[model samples]
Target: MVVVGHIFWLSDFGRFAVFGFYILSGYLMTYIMHTSYGYSSLGRKKFATNRFLRLYPAFWAAILCSIVITLFWGSSSNGFILPTNLAAIIGNTTMIFPHWMPSQIEPRLSPATWALTVELFFYVAIALGISKTLKRTYIWISLSVVFIVLSYVMNLYWHARYFSIPAGSLPFSLGALIFFLSKQKSVRYIPEAILASPIKLFFTSFCIAIVTSIAISQSLSFWLMEIIFYFCMAINFLLVLSLAKQNTFVNGLSTKLDKKIGDFSYPFYLLHYQAAAIASVISLGKVASLKENFSLISCMLTFLILFIMSLCVIKLIDKPVEKLRQTIKAK
Candidate 1:
């Protein structure tokens, strides 16, 4: 959704899809900590190391791609600008200053990286034991609520929605709450409404349709839309991740296919702008202006190049990094 929204429909919903990623991240990191990396000192070290390994190598490669594209084959549509100052360059490369800080509005080579800055913040929080105990997790969730309410009251809700480090904890902490709920003793008897994947999918789709219909008919409040989007998308992602645990044939096959496609996600997220730039360069000046003359052919070419570039990064950088991550994780 982020890729489609950014690459093809830049005017629409690409940025909101990142909230779904935050929820998914919270759930996944919680599961990993409980199952493999415990709350011990050594475990904390390993967890932090593992998370960096998971993100940084591909991220750096994407930075390289972005730099090359900006210097050699820049495009106007993807907003690919190389930061001229040393500080901005360092901040962009290390993802240290992608926030909404007024004094530090660093030139982002890849616009998608601001969310990654948020992700790294949560990674540190998780490693610091915010997600360790159910009680602590609840505290984390409470912080999210407080931040949301305060931001809304102060008229900073939308601004804080994506880039405000403190307020952005809403989705991450909500995801942790979901993980903690599933682990409760009472969850063993969870209603089939949520436990069954088919039912989960159906109910989510039905609610979405109902919501869309209602939204079309009348003005639904912004909060209502936010609630619906977060609840629906979080569970939907959990369903996707849980497919691997299912014994059914279709579900099992879906998991296998999902794992393969998942590899493209990170690389594509980081390198997509460069892909667009590359497409623009290759279009023989046809894509001079995305607003007027960017053809369907240009869009498809961007997508194709994105996939090829992502696949190459996965094979060349991500695969070897994965092996090393697994080896370290095994310890």
Candidate 2:
């Protein structure tokens, strides 16, 4: 959805998508650490190693792909910029290009990847046991609220990089809170309808909001959209918790599909921007503008290419890394 927003000039749903990613990351990381590894020194080392293996190999692959695609067929269009030189290639591979390099020189191979920088920082912080200070649910909740408030204020008055730090941090903290809350006895056994109905409504309203805002981009203000987005995300977080334990959807079919979806998600996200750019170049000629050339057919072509590419990377690259991690764990 975030990639779709970037490609199609839809409402600012990308912000919520990134925030949701942070929250999910926080919950999963915390759960894995608490249960699988605990807080031992050796455990932290293993955790950090597993994290790197899980993320970096695929990222390096994406960087290489972006470079090749951008070098031959890249055009700056609809706010998408491609890497052009060795410096960008190096910086993007490091995953710190947007943060460390000067904005003018910083090539946005995939501008959406700036969030990954923030996520990497959080991963390091968690591995170093910075989460020790946030044990109590109240503390986690309070910090989450503070971060969200700070993000909102920063976004109102500050530039992109400045707001991004807090914006990224906010959902991560919320994820920790959700994890803690899930451990409570009272969180169990909600009526299924309480969750299922809202989730259904959320998807419906979210689609309506995105389409309506894009249709009337002139009438929609940023602040108004922000309000709607946050409301949707809050409802989503609630749904995340409600459905955390109840995974069997008609005897495990949904769970298997969900895992497959998860396997493809990160690679798809990393590759989609460049894939869209490549699609534009293919359909509209090398030099054509993205806005002029973009159509339903181009979008479908991009999706097909991205899906196939992501599937291949997951099977060929990501799965081997996973196997290596499991082998190490077994040892």
**Regions of candidate 1 where Cα sits further than 4 Å from its true position:** 75-77, 98-104, 184-190, 198-255, 284-292
Ten contiguous residues with the weakest lDDT in model 1? 240-249
- What does candidate 2's lDDT look like per residue over 128-166, in tens digits? 655544455356557756755765666654234233554
> In terms of TM-score, how similar is model 1 to the real structure?
0.84
Query: Per-residue lDDT of 1-331 in model 1, one digit per residue for the tens?
Result: 6676565543325544566678778888887888889888999899988888888888888888877776775545455677788888887778777545421364677767877777888888887889888899889889888877887788875556556777558788867766667654444444544545644564564456455435734766767766765566655555533432341424446766868987888988888777877787788452343334468888888889999999998899889989999999998
TM-score of each predicted structure versus truth: 0.84, 0.84
Candidate 1 at residue 173, lDDT? 80
lDDT of each: 0.70, 0.66
